[model samples]
Every structure is written in C-alpha cells, then in structure tokens.
Target: MSIKGAIKGLLATLASGCLAAAVGGIVVYAHGFSALASLRDGPLPPVQQTRLFADLAAALDGLGVILALLIVLVAGGSMAWVFLAGRFIAGPLAALRQALGDHAASLGVHLPREEAEDPWTPEGLGTTLRGLLELVASREADLVASEAHLAAVIDAIPVGILAVESTGYIRSDNLAARLLFGQTDPLVGKNLSALIAPPVHPGIPGRGKDTALDMVTRAAQTHETLAVHCWRDPSLFPADVTARTVSRGGSLTTVVTVHETTERRRAEAERAHHRALVSAALEASTDGFLVVDLDGVVISWNRRYYDLLGLDSDVVPRLPQAQRYERVRAVMADPDAFHALYDRLVNDPATTVVETMHLAGGRRLDVFTGPFRVDGVVAGRLWTERDITERERVQADMARAKEEAENALAELKETQAHLVEAEKMASLGQLVAGIAHEINTPIGIAVTAASHIADEARELAVAVKANLLRRSTFESFLETVHDSATVLLSNVRRAAELIQSFKQVAVDQTSDERRLFDLATYTQEVLLSLGPSLRKAPQRVEVDIPPDLMLDSYPGAMARVLANLVLNALMHAFPGLPAAGTRDDTPDAPREAVGFPGCLYLSARSLDDERVEMRVADNGVGMTAEVRRRAFDPFFTTRRGQGGSGLGLHIVYNLVTRTLGGRIEIDSAPGQGTCFVLTLPRRAPEVPVAAPSQCDASGTLGGDSTV
Candidate 1:
C-alpha cells in the first residue's frame, strides 16, 4: 500500500502499455505501410466506381478506418497488457507491505520511508495502529472491572461511604451512606445539607441544617481531613457512628463505620452487677478472702480480711519496687519464703502446699497457695487465706476438754464405785428379807447334812470303838461323814453365789459388751438390782416377757430406764399406808413402798428391717397429758420429791433419738400406766451439735446438744 509500490505498479503498467502499444503500432504501421508501398509500387487496388464523393470519401475513410483499426488494436493490446501487469504486481506489493510493517514493528523505532508514509504501507505504522486499538479495548475492560470491585467493597462494609468534590458537592454516596443521611437522590452533584433535605436527628452527622455543608466547605478551604463521632437521636437510645475523612485520589472523602453499642452496654451493666454481688458477698462473708496478682500485689481485699486484722486500704502499706510488701513481709518474716514457694511450683510445675500461718496478734490462718493457669500456662499464683483461727481455737478447747473429760471419767468411776457401795449397803438392807428367805432352805439343807454327818460320825466312832470292824466297813463310815460335810459346804457356797450375782447385776449392765440376752434375763437382772423394792407391792408384780423376745439397745440405758420407771411406780403410783393407820408418814425413803398393786412391763420388737422399738410401761398412777408433754424435759418430773433426779426420761430421750436417731413417744393418762414407746433406728446418725436452747421452753430435754 505504499506510494512507491503503487507508483511502481502504475509505471510498470504504463511502461507495459507503452511498450505493447509501440509494438502493436509498429507492427500494424509496418504491415499497413508495407501494404501501401506494395500497392503503390506493384499494383494499386482499383478504385471502384462507387460514387465519386462516396468513393473518394470511402477510400479516404477506408484508409482512415484501416488506420483507426490499427490504432484501436494497438490501444486494446496495450490496455490488456497494462491490466495484466497491474494484476500481477498488486498482490505481491500488498504482501511485501505487510511484511515490512511487521519487521519495522520488531525494531521498536519507525523505519525510514520515502513515499511520504503510504496509508496501506506494510511498515511499523500498521503495527502501531493495531496496538492502539487493543490498548483502547483493554482500558474499557479495566474501567468496568474497577467499577464492579468498588461497588462490591463499598456495599459489603457496614459503614456508609461517600466521595466529595473540592466545591463541597457530593460526588457519590453508597447505599448505607444514603440511608443514614436520608437522601435518596444518589447524592451526586448535590451540596450535602445545603440543598433542601429532610430534618436531621441530633446525632446524625452534620445534624444542624447547613452544618455539614459548612464543615465540608471548611475542610476544602483548609485542605484538611476531619473525623467525628455522631449518633441518630430519633429515639432516647441513639445509634452512634464514627465518620472519618479519607483521601481518595487527592480528594478528601468521608467514611463511617457504624456501631450499635446497646448490647455492649448491657453486658457491661451485667458485669457490674456481678462485681457488686461479689463485693457484697465478700462484705458479708465470715471467711476472709483476698485476690492478688502473681507478685502478691493486692488487687482486692475483702471486709473480713481487713476487719479481722484491723487493716484496710487506709492502713495497708504501699511499697513499690520491693520484693515483698511491708504487711506480707511482717507476716511472713522470712524474706525469701514466698519466693521459695513460688519457685517450688514454677520449677517443678506440679507442686502445691497447704500451710498453716501463725500471724501477728495471736491470730492464725490456713493459707492455701497454688499456681494459676491462663490458657493452660502458668501465669500467676493464687493464695487463699482462711481464718481457721476459730477452728484452731475450738480444737484447742476440745483438747483441754478431752483431758478434763478423762479426769471427769476417772472421777465418775470413783464416784460410781462409791455409789455402788452405797447402793450395795442399801441393797443389803433391802435384801436382808430375801436373803433370809433363801437361807432358810440352805440352812435346812445344812442342818440335815449336819445331822446326817453326826450319825455317820457316831457310826464311825462305834466302829472304831468296837475295834472289831474290818477296814472296808470303817472306810465306808468315813466316806459317809465326808459326803455329809461336802453337802453342807456346797449349800453354803450356792447361797453366796446367788448373793454375788444379784450384787453385780447393776454394775455389769453398764459394760460396753452387748449380748443377745433373753428379755427375761435382762428383766430379772434389773429386778434383782431393784430387789429392795419388791415387797412394796401389795399384790404380786406380774412380768409378761415372751421367752423368745430379744432386742438391740444399750442395755445399760435400758436397765436404768426400767429401774427409774419401776422406782417411779413404787414412789408415786401407790400411796404408802402410813403404819396401816395414817394417810401420810413422817418421812419417806428414796423409793417408797406402795400400798396398792403395781406392775412393770418391758417388751421389744423388730419394728422394721434395721431397727427395734422397746417399750416399758408401768401400771402406776400415770401422768396427765400436760405432764406427758413435758415428760422428757430435764428437771421436769411428776415425782418432784423422793430423790427423782428428773433426768431419767430426758437422758433416755436423748440416747434414743440423738444417739440412735430414733423417736420416743409417751402415751399416758391419769390413773393409767405410762408407756414409753421408743422407735429406734438400728444405725447411727451423723449430725453437728445443735444450738444452745433458751431456758423455760416447753417440751425440751436435757441441755442443748453440742453444735
């Protein structure tokens, strides 16, 4: 497509056309001239008699036509040759132009051209043109992609975005920005808050009319960015937002990140409430607690901890950069003790210690120390100091009481021995009748043995005196005397054994060893202990104990309960016949002999799988309902006088209910026998000592149990 190539093609065509025309003209002229010469010289073609004018004109016209025909043929051949030459050259020139264009492009500089830069030339210019078209197309694609990315990023963020021009005109606003400002006009080219718009909330950005416009104007004038926080105060609760002016391609634009702080505010309030609860608990708690850092810096101290030691923030020592503080140093004494413990745990990583600290002011604390782990790594140490001072004091008192208790036990044993002796003496006085009654049989047996012995001895003497008896007869008579004497000794020993068993029955019942005793055995034993009062009953006292009945109970307490009830029967149930004449006597014994029939009954049964209930009912003048209500009360008794200690039923109630964790009920009416029904569990119950009781309370037993 270059001018040189076109000119060459034209020239070649012209040259070819000229050469062909010249050849054709020469050949045609040569052939015609030759024919003319041949005709003039040899024989001229006869001119026909074809009308003088027509013939002359025709001959001339014929000469002209032949010449014309010759010219036409030459022109036609030249045109064809020119056309062929053009056709042959045009395709090559075009291809050659293209190659030259590609080659020039590879060189990076435009190649020198002579044809004044042909339009269709195959040179660097064509490559430059193609490159320009591709560049323009790529720019269009990039512009589209950038717009898409900007839109995506802006919409994804919660904060509204905007771009502003130097003239304070809004260039663009994202969806969020438009919503916040209550403008739906795309906000572009609009002066923010300057033009007519809706009313603004207090917290809305640029709240006052023209305020935002003035701010933007000032910013443009000053060429500075602005940052501000605002809220939409449509409601009492406001939505707060932070707006920042950021530079975008040399222009300042506003971007806001919105936040609704209601939830965070509520959570903070809840945390405050929890902190208040902790503070209150610390204030009210009896245990002293402290929260500290790893270095034992006191972060928090509760009321008890401060109150007990007379220390508070006012009195607490403040010493910075010290290995240990004044208070802790004074308390610990050893400068490196805390560090030693800290190192012990830090080094081994699995050590803990419970230490007993004897602090100042004669106080004590059980301090437990351990490592604190944050994210499964040791970050600090936590120390819990319990004011076990009370427990220690109690333990000390208990030890002292134990020693005193041992002494008391010894004294009680001695006193009981003496009481036993007194009772034995009283018993001997009472048992004199029974002993005498029983001895009559032993005495008769002894007397009969003695008589038999005398006879035997006399026979032995006669045999010896005769001096004529054989050895066998003398041996037989001596054996008879020896056997009689043995019978008399045996009778005396039997009587002594009965007295001893009766005497020991009361003391032996208090032993710790328990036995499967037939109720009969225990009843008889208690009766023998109370042998002195048997004759007080006018009628025979009836005992109805099933032969096979057994029970589980502390027989010592049971025996005592039986004895007390029986003693009550003797003293209160029946009125003494004063000398069989007067209604009253001058004085009464601890146990008075009754003038009426009185009976004592003791029974037991397996109330359930794990327990037995024992009963002791006495056919004595029973108590009224009012008295029954307070029957177990210490020092409350129907028999106010006659040595009633009044602790019998009270002790029985405690032993059964507290010790056995069982219940005791009393059913009694005036003039009827009182029945003490005990429903006892066969297991022990664990419970702390109870609180002390107030005096004069109704239906109370014994002293308050230990708490």
Candidate 2:
C-alpha cells in the first residue's frame, strides 16, 4: 500500500488498540467491585470471615486475571488484523506502481493480458487508467502512421528536395535528393558542396553556399528563385537546380529543388532527328505530295509540288488554302472540275478519287486524293501527282503492234487450214492406192480363172472333133468347170467388198451423218480402214470398246477425230524409226525405248454417264508443257518444215467439241508420251458451237471452234 495509506492504517490500529485497552480496564474494575462486595458482605465469623475473604479474594483475583486476559486478546487481535490488512494492500499497490511505470515508459503500449489485476485499486480508478492508456496508445499509433505517410509522399516526389543550413551543412534531404545525387548513405551533416560539382555554365551563379545564400536572401525579397545547372560524378547526371531562402526558428534555411533534364533533352534530340529524316524523304520523292488538314488548311508540301504545277517556289505554306488553290487554278485546264472534286472529297471522308488532268502545256497528270488516316480515323487528305505523258504514248504504240500481230496470226491459220485439207486428201489418195492394190489381186485371179475355163471348153471341142473324147474326160471337164466357176465368183465378191468398205469411209468423212450405230463395230471398221498406214508403222493399235455400246451421234465426226489423232501420233511419235509393219505384242517392253519395239497407240472407248469417253494415247515421243498447251492451236507446230501443219489436232478438237457435243483434253510431257481424251454426249448437239468445257490442256479452252 502507499505510505500514506499504511501510516493511516497504523494510526487506526493504535486507536483501536487504545479503545480495546480502555474497555478491558472498565470490565476489570466492574468485575473487581463485584468480587470485593462479595467479600465485604461475608456471612461467617471473623476467622471464618478472614478465610472466606481470602477465598473471595482468590476468586476476585481469578476474575481479575480473566478480565486481563480478555483485554490482551482484544488488543492483540486488533493489532494483528491491522498488520494483515496493511500487508495485503501493499502487495497490490506495489504491483500497480510497477505496471504504471512500465506503461508510462512505453507511452501506454500494450502489456500481457495475463497480468493480475490490482485488487488495492478501485474498479472505477482502474477503468479510468485503462481508458487514458488506450487513448495514448491510439495517438501513438496514429503518429507513427502519419510519419510513414509523409515519408512515402516525399519519396514519391519527382524532384529532389534539400533543406540546407546557411552554414553549408545538409540539414535534411528527401529520397529524391539522395537518388539524384547517386548517394545511398545518409546525407545529413554532410557539406552540400561535397555532394554536387560546381555549375558548368557560369551564367547560373549562386552555386557556392555564400553566393547561394546571398542569392536566396535576395530572391526572398524579389519573390523569385535562382536556377543553376549542377552535375555530379559517378552518375554524371545533369540536374536543374532552383533555390530559395526561408527563415524558420530564427535561422536561414535554403530549400533547393532539383529536376533532372537528361530524358527531356534526349527526347528533343530524337524528335529533331526524325524531322530531318522526314524532310529528306520528302525532298527525294519524285511525285508531288501535299498534306492538308480536315479544314482544308495546307500544312505542308514538298518541292516537287511546285515543280509539277509549274508554279513559283517562292510561295510559302502560311498562305491560306484558298489563295493556294487560286494560284494552282491559273494553270488548270478546268478549274471548276478541280474545285468540285475537292469539295466532294472533303465532304465524303472515306472516298478516294483518281483522275487524269490535261494541263495547259499538254502535260498529262495522274492525280490521286485519299484520306490520311492516323490511328484508323481520317485526319486529313493527301494528294499525290504524277506525270503520265510518256506512258500514254507507249501504250498507243503497243496497241498498234498487238493489232498487227493478230492479223498475222489470222493469215497463218488460214494457210494451216489449207495444208490440213491437203494432208487429208493425201491420206485419201493413199487409201485409194491400197484399195486398188487389194482389188487388183482379186480381179487378176478372177480373170485367170475365167481364161482357164475357156481353155477347158476349147480343148473339149477339139476332142469332140477328133472323135477320141471319153465319158471320164467329160466328167473331169465338168468338175474342172465347177471349180473354176466357184473360184471366179469368190474373187469377184472379195473385190466388190473391198470397194464398198472404202466407199463408206470416204463418204462418211466428206459428210456428217448422225445415226444409231454400234460404237465397237464402227470403231473396228475405222481402224481396219487405216490398215495400210498401221501396217507401215511398227506400232500397236488397241481398240478397247464395249460391243453393245450404241450412240446416235455424228459418226463422221468421230471418224475424223480418230483419223487425225492416229495421224498425229504416227508422224510425231518414233520420229526416226522406219516403217516395220505391225508391232509384236510384248507387254513387258519399256514404253520409252527409242527402237521400234516400243511404238504403241491406244484407242479405247468407254461409256461415261450419258456420254462416251474415248482416249487416244501413244507411247511415242511426247510433248513438253509449252507444246501441249499450244498443241491444239492453229498453225502451231514443232515440225514446221517436216510436213506437220499443226491443224491435225486442231481439227480433231473442233470435231469433238463443235460437231459432237464433247470436251477434249491432251495430257503430254517430254518423255512420258501423250494422251488425247475426248468426252462426247450420246447424241450430237444441234448447235454448231464448241462446248464450253473443251480444252487442249488442263482446264482451259482458249479458242473458238465454230465452222
């Protein structure tokens, strides 16, 4: 307990002790009187009385002793109770003092929640103390937060802030100051001159403390600050510094703000470099270029613009756009047209226009006007002007040359057509010769058989005149006559059949006849008619067709197509191999062999959907890509001087497409051989125009096939 409370308790204990002593004395006195009275009023004789009195005295003594003991007990109990109360109160009071001292030292920081409560203190007093400590703790926390926020704000500032004393010592500096100075150590107490070098340009004075302070003081009067350039080593940073003096607490403090200008200066240099590059590009351009804003305000123009317009170069861009247009209009052939186009372009932001302008000096100009977009939105209009006088002249010349070339090509096709007809007539003559040769043998045999029969008849007449004829001779003569008659009839019929076959082929080639006929039978007849030429060449001619396939198409056209294809293959394929009759059937022989063993021509027909597909292929010398492309072109032949008129395939192309409603394609390469595939409808088309799908190569039909 506190000393005051302890002393008060001691005094109260003494007073209680005195009260107890007084009460004890009173009780003893009363008890003693009662005992004495009992002795005085004795009921015995003098000697008995004396003995009784002694006994009574002893009883009274006993009573007195009992009274004394009671007094002692009361005093001792009062003292002991006060001492125990003092000890219990002192323990808590001491603990409370120590706790309060610790809390005060820490400015009321929190302590362990497990500490015992001070029983000596009252509840209200403890509550009041706790509230006060909490208030102090909250204020302390807020103070710490505020300090941290202020420090962060200062650190985030871009410019360096330095507060220096007039004595040249750095009193305080923010984070920016240390960063700008490239110093990580504490800046306080360091001399200001030691951190930064002197200003390079002397015009910016007040770098030293004395001069800076003088300037700062003068600036205070003028309400302006002095600026200087300071550079520091190790980081070679150039900073712009401004200083002003402030009077605080009766001392002069200079507050300097430093701003680094390196990045700004670098950005300015890059901008200048880009401007130079743009200027060079504009000057080097051949076309006239002009840039105008959305308001028709001319922003810039290159030198070529004046040169192209034949205007004076002295005109400046600052002139209004109207004045510039008027100057340009003086040389325009139609000024109103230019004005109308300009207005249209300005109103419709998305439209770009290109026009040719005929100028006063006969110079042609190609002018283009379009929107100049920046970031996907139209900002202005850009005009580019190019002179096209020479280009027009060259184009006119090329047109004339192309017309001449076309005329020459037409004449050449006419000549080739005649040659192709001549070739067909020559082929016909050869067929006639072969037929004549075949018929001559049969006619000669028939003539010899008839002559023999006449001789036998004459000999029998001689025998009858001589009268030496026998019945056996007559019978033999009859038998001989029967054999001769039979032989004569057979030979004559064979000759007539040969004549009929040749006649049918020749008539069909000259005339187009559409009739229902078996394709296999007709194809066989056509190939058989070409037996003479096929026999001369060491080549295999295969006819693959279904026997029952029938078509109501122009058989004449088909006959011509097959004949022309066979002719082309024989003449172009196996160029150096001599005519060696029919080829041997050797399936394993290489197709590319240069000898006579490899010459093969395949003519196969198959029925496609509602049409017939015929393929004429050869394992002979094939064409290159260029040749195959122009293979069906009129008068286009690789063998110009060697009897190749180039119209063979062309005629075949026409017959397949124009006569019969079909498409034809030629697939050929240098050494791999050539194939001509023709697809015809079941019935011939009435219209005499070529089918749109016909072509000599891969998917393109480049020419007309009309009669």
Candidate 3:
C-alpha cells in the first residue's frame, strides 16, 4: 500500500475507536451506573422491576466494562499504529524528496519523473526516483567524459581552433590558435581583435573597416568563411577562418577554425620568379632555339627561331609542331631534303644530326639537331640554327690569296737567279778586257824590236858577199844586234808574265778551287791586272798587306773582290771634268800637283788566331744613311738608270760569307768616305759556291760600295 493509504486507514480506526468509547461513557452516565453520576429519580419500567431486573443489571455492568476496555484498547492500538506508520512513511518520503531535489539541482532538471503512472505510492515514488537518480549519474559521467574527449580532440588538431562569442570575446581557443597569434597567456575571455588583425570587409561599401569580432559575427550570421591576416610579432601568417553559429538555451556562440597559408603563398611566388627568369633567358639567346614535346606540341621558342623559319610572331609558340614544320618546309629551297632531315631527327634520337641549308637568296645556314632530355631519357628534339654564309666567303678568299702568293714567289726566285748569273759573267768579261789590254802593250814592243834586229842582219849579209870584212862594220852590226836582242827579250818576258798571272786569276775565279797562297802577292797581281782601268782615274792604290799572311781559301773569289773594289773606287771617286780649254802659259807646279792629287784607296790585312781581317777604304763621296741601310739588297740601287746593276756589294757579301765562310761589315757617312771590312777564315768550305748572274761591265765601274 501507498504511505498515504496506510495513513488514511490508521486515521479511520482511531476515529471509530474514539466514537465507541464516547458512546459507552454516555451510556454509563445516563443509566446512573457510574459513581460520578447521580442516580436519576426516574422510575423503572414494569418488566425491568421484576425479578430479572437484578440479573439484567449484573449482565449490563459486566458487558459495559468489557466494552469500555475494548474501546480503550482499540484507541490506544490505533494511536500506536498511526505513530509508527507515520514515522516510517514520513522518513522515506522526506529522504526521497531531498535526494530528488539534490539530483534535479545538479542535472538542471525538475524533480520526480513526470512520466510515472503512480508517483504517490511509496514503492512507485522510490522506484521512479532511484531510476532517475541512477540515469542522471550515468549521463553526468558520460557528459564529463565526452567534454574531456572533445577538449582533447580540439587541442590535438593541427589547425588553429577558436570558439568565440557574439560579444567579441573568445570563449575558448586551442594551443595552435594561441601559437598562431603568438600568445603565451590563456586566450579564453580575451578580445579577438587584440590577438589578430581586424578583418577586412572588401564587399561592404562605405564601411571600409571592421574589427575581427564584428567580421566574425557577420560571418556566423551569414554562414560564410572569412580570410584574415594575423601577425605573431615579427612573423605574419594568412589564415582562412570559418565561423559557425551554435544555438543552446536560447543563446548563440561562434566556433571559428583557422588554417595558415604562408608556405603556399611563398611557393606560388617562387614559381612566378622562375617563370620570369626562363622568359628572360629565352629572349637573350643569340642562336635560334626551338623546343617541342614528344607529341609534337610546341612548348617554347624564341624570336630568333621565328626569324630563321621566316615565321610570323603570332604563329610561334602557339602552333602544333607538325604544322610549324610543314610551314618551314614549304619555304625551304629543297623541300624534300628538309622533310628527310626532319624525319631522321625525330625517328633517330641516338645520333645528333646536322645539315647545311642553302636558301633562295644565296644564304647558308648551319642547323644542328639533338635530343632534349629530362633526367636520363630523351623527351623531345632541340633545333639550333646559325648563319655561315660570310664565314665561307672569307675562307675562300684566303685560299685564293695563298695560291697567288705562291706563284709570285716562284717567279721572283727565277729572276733572282738570272741576275746573279749576269753579274758573274760581266765580272769575267771585265777581267778579260783588262788583261788583253795589258798584254797588247808588251806584245807590240817586242814585235817592233824584232823587226829592227832583222833589218840589221840583212845589211850585214850584203857587205859580207862583197868581201869588205872590216872591224868598224862588224862592230856596228854587233852593237845593233845586241841592243835589239836585249829589247826583244825584255818585252817577250813581260807579255809571258802577264799571261801567266791572268791565267791563274781567271782559273781560280771560274773553278772555285781552294789553294794556299800568299795574300800580299795575290793583291799585287790583281792590281797589275786592273792597271789599265786604274790609269784613267786620278787615284793612288796603297797596299798595307802582311807578306807572310797566307790563307788556304778560294783565291778566285778573293781576286774578284779586290778587283771590283779597286775599279769601283777609281771609277766613282774622281768626277769626270772637262780638260781646260787652254793650258796656263805660266803654270805653277805646286798648283798643278795639288789639283791633280785625287782620291786615295787603301787595302790592308791582319791575322788574328785562325781568321784574317781585310779592309778596303777609299776617300771618295760617301753615302747617306738611307743608302747604307739596304746596302746588301740583291737588286736595290740608287743609280738604276745610270749603269748600276746593284749587285756589286751583294756578290761580294755572298762570296765572303757563303763561299769563304766569313762575315763583312761596312761603315760610311756623308762627306766622310766609306769602308768595307771583311772577316774571313783561313780555310774555305769544301762545297762549291753557286755562281751568280752575269753583270754589265759599266755597272761594276764607279759603283757605290754601299750596294
């Protein structure tokens, strides 16, 4: 039974017991049965006055007593039951009320289970409350655990997280959010604007600025995502924040999520810079370079590449590779050849291909083709073109010039040989003429003396036939014969000596034979042979040669050198002057001698160890600096049209140096005369020196020794 029902039953029993007791006491008082009540003066009834009256009185008394006792017992028992029952019921009810109240306060709900059918019963109330309290406890524990797990999940997330209220304050923030804002303190209850930059509202007109809280509120209301820039003192990070409105208990809170975009932005900027660099490099290239993918899609090209193919700017880097190739092939001089070459480059990537293309306007281009590689594998083809027309022309010109120079050199050598031989023959002819002139004088004298001796002999033969033999006639005949004979012998011997000397000098020059000979004697003999030419000039030849200076060398070359020098001096030193129209009737002897005293030529030699030093000098007109510089040039001369072959000194130089294995030097100055110094070895070379060209006789005479 319920506590209320039990209490009600107890109260009803108590009321009934009280009523019975009250009735019994009334009966006793009315019948005058009690001592406290006075006996009523009322008469008894007829039947009751009889003999049964006494027995009836006894019965009534006993029954009255029994009933009184029973009523008392019933009342007392009912009271006791009411007190005990009330105590038990009241204790449980009070306890249940307090427990329900405490649980309702903790869980924020009303007390008691509203869905119970008999909540007034003690068992029902107790059972309902126990189930409610147990459910509340389990749910409370689950709520606590779920909250802790949620907090853990939010904190563990990599991206920054924040829970903000509409009041512009942060309700909560994760560790990442604190770090993103560069905050060390707790972020809860802090103003959102103070941690991050104020959000920008670009779409809002007239209201140019807004705080983070205001923007976040707007994002929540509009259910939109916001891009915000935040700074952590020295570092800046861009964040994408998403705001959501959470409604609970008729109120709203905003949940914000933050994501950083710094690295992504930096990567985009680096890619932009790399693209700019590639563009700059392509523009700066000199050669025309073209690149295409393996599928024949044009990937990159430069302006030069367009120019080489005669392509329009709009067509490059936009056309397919096959179309571009066809366009270029159409303009080629040999279209079929270009097609073959292009096919080879595309199909055969292992070998690099090169070709020279000749254009319609005589233009030449060197084109090179090779594979473009990514890592180790070929990905595409590369083409580079360069013009080579000018280079080829320059090479051709150089070759032609080299051939012409070779032909000219050959002709020069031939001319030089003829000049050398001509100079040599001229020298010999001069020697022969001078020797012939010398022999004629001696031969003429001998012939005249022999004729006179013959006449004297004829006159003596006639006188002997008449027998007129006398001492005076015989004596005259003898005197004439002796004088003629002596004249004939002297002249004949002189002619013979001249012939012998001439033979030796001529043989040595022509034969190039080496012999040991006295230099002093050779010098005297050469001077004698040149005497005929020397007599025409007013010059004195002085020889200061050492008589004992003997040399084992080519005497013929030596004799030619000496004769040329002496004849040169005699011919050049004295100027040809017209004879005086009339000789002075009274001539001063000293004046005549002074006027006729002309140039002086000197020849000298000395010995030093195994070499000989010979010098030929003349006091004649000297040479200038310009004339002395090219003194030994083969065909150089100052008097080109005046009988000068310019080979006199050249031959002398070659003979002394090559034939005689020696050196020669010259010293001269204007108005100071000239000198030729020769340094020769005592022994000549075994190899014969080649002869030079024949010469003009006039060229040898009166020529400057400088050449």
TM-score of 2: 0.54
Top-TM-score candidate index: 2
Q: Please provide TM-scores, in order, for all candidate models, with all chains considered together.
A: 0.48, 0.54, 0.54
In lDDT terms, how accurate is model 1? Answer: 0.53
Error at 44, model 2, angstroms: 86
Supply every candidate's count of residue pairs whose N, Cα or C atoms clash at under 3 angstroms. 7, 1, 12
After superposition, the stretches of candidate 3 with alpha carbons farther than 4 Å from their true spots are 1-347, 352-357, 365-388, 458-486, 511-515, 525-529, 559-607, 686-707
Please give the lDDT score at residue 205 for candidate 1: 53
All models, RMSD in angstroms = 20.3, 20.9, 21.5
* Candidate 3 lDDT by residue in tens digits, 1-707: 33344334434433122111121122222222343132233333435333223433344444342111111112211211011112224444444345445545565644555455555443344355445545555665787899899988988998888888778788888988887788887689888777557645343222247777777777777877677776677755677777888886677888888888778768878989898888788777767887777777777777887776667856656876677777888778898898888787667775688889976557778888778789989888787887788889988998898888776755665666666566656767766877888888888988888898888777788888888768899999899888988988998998899889988887876767889999889988888777766676545566778788888998988987887666655555444533232332222221122232344444456666688888777655666787776666666676687777666676776677667787777777775667778888887677433543222332222221211
Clashing pairs in 1: 97-122, 101-122, 101-123, 203-231, 689-706, 689-707, 690-706
**lDDT, candidate 2, 1-707, per-residue tens:** 43334334434432112111121112122222333343333233447523532453355343332101110112121210011122223443344445444544464443333235433333333343445445555665787899899988988998888888888788888898887877787679977666554443355444454543444445456666444445465445545566777888789888777788788768878999998889889889888888888887877778887788888655745677788778877778888887887678767977899999877778788999888898999988888899888889888888898898888767655555556567667657766766877688889999999999999999999999999899999999999999998999999999898888778777676666767877787777677667777777777676667787788888767777787788788888767755553455443333444345345544445567588787777777788888887787756678899988767777787677777878888777787777788888887777454332224454345554232
User: Which 10 consecutive positions of candidate 1 have the poorest summed lDDT?
Assistant: 66-75
Best of the two (2, 3) by TM-score: 2
Sort all candidates by TM-score, best to worst.
2, 3, 1
